[model samples]
Target: MALIAFRRRSPLPPAEAWRRVTDWPRHSAHVPLTRLSTEPPGPTRTGTVVLARTGRGRLGFDDPMEVVRWEPPGPDGTGRCRLVKRGGVVVGWAEIEVRPDGAGSVVSWREEARVRLLPRLFDPPTAWAGRRIFGRVVDTLLAAPPRSAGGPGRPDGPGRGARRRGT
Candidate 1:
């Protein structure tokens, strides 16, 4: 098993930081060759299944994770979430925590992942890759603007369609 953990501090408040990190689909923007989708598509909560399909068309594998715990920031500005990976290729659990820090916030991500058929000797490399990839994901998520309700890159929004048409 590979254990991965990292923390990032952001200028955004705890609530906003939580929102950015918890928006599952946005994760695809940062993870290469991966697209994320949620079952019962809507707001995520306990029992929501997040499926990440990685690699090209037929050459891919699905990493499905079911949210077992969901806690949004409360009055004290602390939130936590946990997900269990339920997939044939990979298995483990992940946790995300957000805590208030002065006027900003701190986000921590922890995961215990194991890829099937892989030997224990690869644990160090696996953990290193996980940290690099997930660290970038979290950093990018926090830096980007929050997606509007209409969603990013929607043609219906003002000037969006025109921009797409290159007019």
Candidate 2:
């Protein structure tokens, strides 16, 4: 598997980012080409997150995904996520995590892709693309600030479990 990671700090508080990441259904609102479905077989934590993404013309159509392992690190928490599926085979994976910074927080994402159709000789290209895609996603999240936590009329400060997930 090829590994790629990107780190970025968000302006929003930990609570805001936690809520946004756990609520997968609403993710498409912030992320482009990413349609995440929260409801699926099994518990939401380890449950499957289906994504329909249309890639290049060569990819043929919207790429279907079977996602699992989702988490938002707490004040003292650690987390990771991964994915797999390519045509009739499984060849994709990702591990994302977040940790508390001094005032805000930092997110680190590691991803890997292995396509069977392509010979092993193309592993370098796959790794390069993974880095680019993961970088863009992290950048987008940093640019879009999160909504205030708590609820309407009543804003919340930080929660009890806000911890650091980056180096």
Candidate 3:
């Protein structure tokens, strides 16, 4: 199995960081040729299934993952979510954690994956690529937008859309 793990620190608060990291559909925006769908079509919890379909037309594959554990951040508390991949083409598990830092928060991701029919010799490269791709996704998700000149917003800062408009 290919194993990938990494950590990132962000200026956003723990709850905000958890929210950003756990936003399932947003993942499709970051990954190429991928679309996300959740079962039960609402707030996620244990047993929620997140499906990611990738590829073009009939060439696509599904990476269906079921939430095995879910915990949102509490006031001054850490949050954690774990998912188990249950697709014909992919199998493994992933865990995401968000915790309060000095004034912001730190997020960590760890994943183990195995592609059907792939030899174990390629695990190293697969893990490397997974790290690069998922790391970028995490970075993009955690990055905070530039604050407006003097406008007041959340204590952490303005939303990503607002920061983009300022530029």
lDDT of each: 0.83, 0.53, 0.80
User: Clashes in model 1: which pairs?
Assistant: none
Write down the worst ten-residue block by lDDT for model 1.
158-167
Query: Which residue ranges in model 2 land beyond 4 Å of their true spot?
Result: 20-43, 55-68, 77-79, 84-90, 147-167
Clashing pairs in 2: 74-161, 75-161, 75-162, 75-163, 98-165, 99-164, 99-165, 100-163, 100-164
Query: Which rank order by lDDT, best down to worst?
Result: 1, 3, 2
lDDT by residue for model 1 over 99-127, one digit each (tens)?
99888888888999998869888888999
Candidate closer to the true structure by TM-score (higher is better), 1 or 3? 1
Flag the better candidate by TM-score, 1 or 2.
Answer: 1
Tens digit of lDDT per residue, candidate 3, span 1-167? 99989888787888878877787877776778988889988889999999999999999999999999998997657999999999999999999988987888888889999988699998999899898777777777677453336432222332232111100
Candidate 2 residue-wise lDDT, 84-109, digit = tens: 55434336766666666666666666
Query: Which pairs of residues have clashing backbones in candidate 3?
Result: none
Error of 3 at 24 (Å): 0.8
Clashes in predicted model 2: 9
For candidate 3, the 10 contiguous residues with the lowest summed lDDT are 158-167
